[model samples]
Target chain A: MEKVMAFTGDEIAAEAMRQINPDVLAAYPITPQTETVQKFSEFVAEGRVSTDMIRVESEHSAMSACVGAAAAGARAMTATSANGLALMWEIIYIAASYRLPIVMPVVNRALSGPINIHCDHSDSMGARDSGWIQLYSENCQEVYDNLIQALPIGEDRNVLLPVMVCFDGFIISHGTEGVAVLEDKVARNFIGEFKNIHSLLDIDNPVTYGPLDLFDYYFEHKRQQVEAMEKAPEVVKKVGKQFGELTGRFYGLLEDYHLQDADLVVIAAGSTAGTVKATVDELREEGVRAGLLKIRTFRPFPQKEIIQKLSKAKAVAVMDRSASFGAIGGPIFLEVRSALFEEQKKPLVISYIYGLGGRDTGINQIKQVYHDLAKAAQSGKVSQLVNYLGVRE
Target chain B: MKLKGWKDIPWGGLILEAGNAQKYETGGWRTFRPIWHEDKCKQCLFCWIYCPDGSVIVEDKKVKGFYYEHCKGCGICAQECPFEAITMEEESKFRKDQGGRP
Candidate 1:
């Protein structure tokens, strides 16, 4: 039987970690993400889980240790946020290149220049091309669910890649919410035991990892990574279905809310999806045909599904919590536009950069975005293709 | 072995062997070869200790001969020999006397 409990996103993520109880956990403390490791440490102290918690000196070493552990045929996991993720950038690529099947929970925070630690997508968005499967969560429940699903997806023989489960920094990480957690035996049974095809510890069959390929084979190795990424969606769906059967909560690449007959839709990710859904409900009550498409898996982006759903709308607004400076719009917007380019009948797609540096995205501000989308639907022209929401001009 | 294609290579370009230096034949790269004098009045083994590649063959604590298959003919052994027990000979000259070596 499942247990219902209230936990902050970080605490729930730690709960999921406790349930999975990976072989190794190498992590460093960074705000928002720190509590996850802290809570997991308490689990270790209480002797609840036998995870070999490695207190690494820095985020770089943390990820490096995870890489070493995973490569040595252990199921390894870690947690980080913002600059800690940035510090692990080099090894992040290495982890994927080696296909380590390590899972990490990333608390989404603003990357520094002004050095502010707050809710934003800049951290994970910056690593969109780092070759890891990225799963975004709307709240604590989803964070727990995503973490549970991440293991099977990444550890799938066909996928064999690292997974990043991201959620808004303070919004979800600090905010407490009710969640349904699976029993340890059932969760373990669902995840099963990790079986690495090639490991450094395989004594009989010796295999090499991270070799130097000048030009003779580098392209093909990269192509293999590409092929693995292409195979992820199917594996993700299958794993999600199995998890849903166990927990009674289904998941998909993207979540569609009231998009069936709506004329206008808003596309966003992470905790902002909850905000958009609320605004959509309020707008629907006012006789406005508003809908939402919340992206769950951002790495193997649900491009076809996004195009199919958004194609029915007369206008679409993509809200990005992170900015892509010097580009036409934010990362999510760019992907949404590119996905729509192949459609025979395209919607009036616009972008809104919002909620940067932990700025509040009130229901009123979200309603204003819906109003703008409705106006664009009526006029059939997007006067402003890209705009900033709630920013002091 | 020949690498047929990129697919033949392992992911992340890992070389698993502890020392694969033997797979590469360094002898062909030599412009000069080191020739050892059997009776140089001393067997100090300085050349064996200083050799970058473990090409120097030592038997019963005595300088035996060079494993020419792996030696690059860098002349380091000839230069490091304390009693001038080794000399660097031009490859062309050494080729003519190759029959004299075991």
Candidate 2:
């Protein structure tokens, strides 16, 4: 059974955690992510879940406790936003290197200097190379779905690495949306029991974990992690397929919105993808061959699928919500532009840095991108390699 | 033993087999090996308790010999021994034929 519940992105994420009912959940509260931890704590207080909720001192310990629990062969999860994620930096890599299969829901907030609490891609982007599988969510619905799917995806024997399911802080995190939540029993069955192969607590086996690996072995161990990362896309596809069957919504590494006949395509991730989708629909109604390629999985980047979906377009605009300092484009734009490099019939690609520090990326701005794409296509070239949207000059 | 390729190893350097540390002989890392003076020995087993690598050999509650295959020759047993029953010796002084306790 499925029920559509009105929940903010944070609330739906907590609702998913409640249903997962993991053996351990350790998290520290930070803006945009605090409500998720608070809601899960409410579940603990109400006896809704059997999870050992560790109200930790900081995000660092929260991630460390999760690493310990997961290494001990228990299902573990945690949630955090910008600065909190920054604090979990060292352990975040350890979780993946140790292959602990810890699941984390990261609310994407702008990293601080002159600090402000709001949505951006800086938090998760900073950990882009931390060896965790990254799933970017467009709205509350994807947040709920991704959190549920992250379990089987990370815990799969072929790909036992940590996973971070990312949704834009406050944009999706605080905004209300009607989300279809799976029945508790159905979700529980899908997640199933965590099958631990090499656990610290598996006393009969008496295994060692995270030992001081030196030059003789450290490189080889790291190579194995890369192999697992290379193997993850298949597991993600399989799990997403299985999840679609359970619920009614299908998912893949990326979503192609009318790309089959599109001459101009816009690429985006997170909440901006939703805005781009709306703009695509409006343009299509007005007889424009506009489309969108929404990135669902950002890490292990799904380059092949991205290339395929974007091949037919005459011009493509890659929108990134975070900036990459001293780079040609933002993170997603860099991947898309690089992926299209070798394609025989590749479209003219351009990059747009938008929505940094929670700025509103309105539908008009998305339409303006389509107009720029059309102009670029007409001129047989993109005037600028990179562009900025929804920001004052 | 040959070093296993990355593909041949476990996913994350997980030591799957218990007591497999015995297969990895760390004794070659030694520069200074320990010499046991059996004549001066009063075997209270302080050396047995103090050996970090469990290299101290004991039999019937008596001091036996060192397991040189696993000892890194840290000399903690010599330092902890109440009496000077054990002493440190440079490995250069010993030839293969004179490499004492197994």
Candidate 3:
């Protein structure tokens, strides 16, 4: 019923796109993300899919065209990384405000200033508040699976907002892994056809989009967007459960590995979660109670769940791959710390900024993090609340 | 129609029709009204071409009259008239002069 084959993350994303066969795809090439569109373009050339691939001149125009296509009652999709996502910033907000269910696969890379094209969370984290549902993948298998599930979650009548599927730039985007390719018919049947509630092309109904709204109604429309986001978590869970029925793989807002009865835990996201899992296994064999909490959904942040999971731990360390310049801790660290504030039994939490600009985060560095967590647990206090792991002091 | 609250307003507050703007009688906003003169009129149609609100009524290649319902009385037609055929007058004075028919 399913075929198992080795494929890169980019190829898996392309395969998902071919299976979805969206009505429109408008994208530009950026490192690590280029292969995704490149492979999709071959699908277009060879007549494997009927998607109208628009080779736009810039990322801004690519997102603009996606908004237009989605407004015109078509299922639109795109892919980008780093600066490409930065260039589409204005239209990104516009797309979400218009409430178009456009899906985008963002190959995560460091935002440029010092000009780095390496794996990091800066790009998507920069857009955390832009009213789009964000799903992070830990490996190639999850990347493919997330992209397929993104459709129903975003296109749901109650949650008509844009969705972004994020994976590490080079680590997961280029890394090859064995993936179970779902049958095209099964994917299609599960996703179903996109039906727009309000379409620009609906001649009889005649509606308008993206009009000027002053103080009288602007706040209400924004509140409506908020309500849609509030409704997303349930829709995402429902869709994930249904997808699990088809593929036998279940997903949740966060994945807990060896967390029960563990005294020290590490919270991380993306491909780094795999390394953390391996290190957790080793720590457990050595009789150390090290655990991991892997974040899967970042946008509609699982705040309550995060607090519940980390509240009883002796000490918690949040590993962030991106920096927040002047902030005391990184983005995820800030969120985790804030969430824990509501809990009476708050654990001693520390922030670790690591693997920025595509620096390798080996198992040794991860073991060091566990060692730090163990020390923090014993001391019941952290000497350095904010730390830079695997970086030159 | 009376708008009760923001919730009653459609999303984005978008107007659905192409020229449905005519539904709003902008004539109420008129401070100065345009008065057309037919005596020294050349009917060159420049006024019709330059009217921003599309309030200049034209039919069969001839200027019919101002569609006052949608006109904001911007005086664009009066400014664009070549033969001094139209003039801007205070709405109060014009209403008194024409007995409120002009």
The best candidate by TM-score is 2
Q: What count of clashes does model 3 give?
A: 0
For A1-393, candidate 3 gives per-residue lDDT tens digits of 779889888999999999999999999999989999999999999999999999999999999999999988999999999999999999999999888989999999999879998999999999998999999999999998999999999999889889999999989999999998889998888889998867899988787788666665688878878888888989988999998888899987889999998899999999999999999989889999989999998888888889888867999989999999999999999999988886778889999999998999988999898898889889887989999998897
lDDT string, candidate 1, B42-84, tens digits: 8888999988999899999988989988888999999888888
Chain A TM-score, cand. 1? 0.99
Query: What are the runs in model 1 whose C-alpha is more than 4 Å off?
Result: B15-102
> Per-residue lDDT for A297-321 in model 2, tens only?
8887998898888878899999988
The digit string of per-residue lDDT tens for model 2 on B47-79 reads: 999898889989998989899889898999999
Q: What total of clashing residue pairs does each candidate reach?
A: 7, 0, 0
Instruction: Kindly indicate the candidate among 1 and 2 with the higher DockQ.
Output: 2
The model with the greater TM-score, 1 or 2, is 2
Candidate number achieving the greatest DockQ relative to the actual structure: 2
**Between which residue pairs do clashes occur in model 1?**
A209-B14, A210-B12, A210-B13, A210-B14, A211-B12, A211-B13, A211-B14
TM-score of 1: 0.90
What's the fnat for candidate 3, on a 0 to 1 scale? 0.45
Provide the TM-score for each candidate, comma-separated: 0.90, 0.94, 0.90
| Model 2 pairs in collision | none
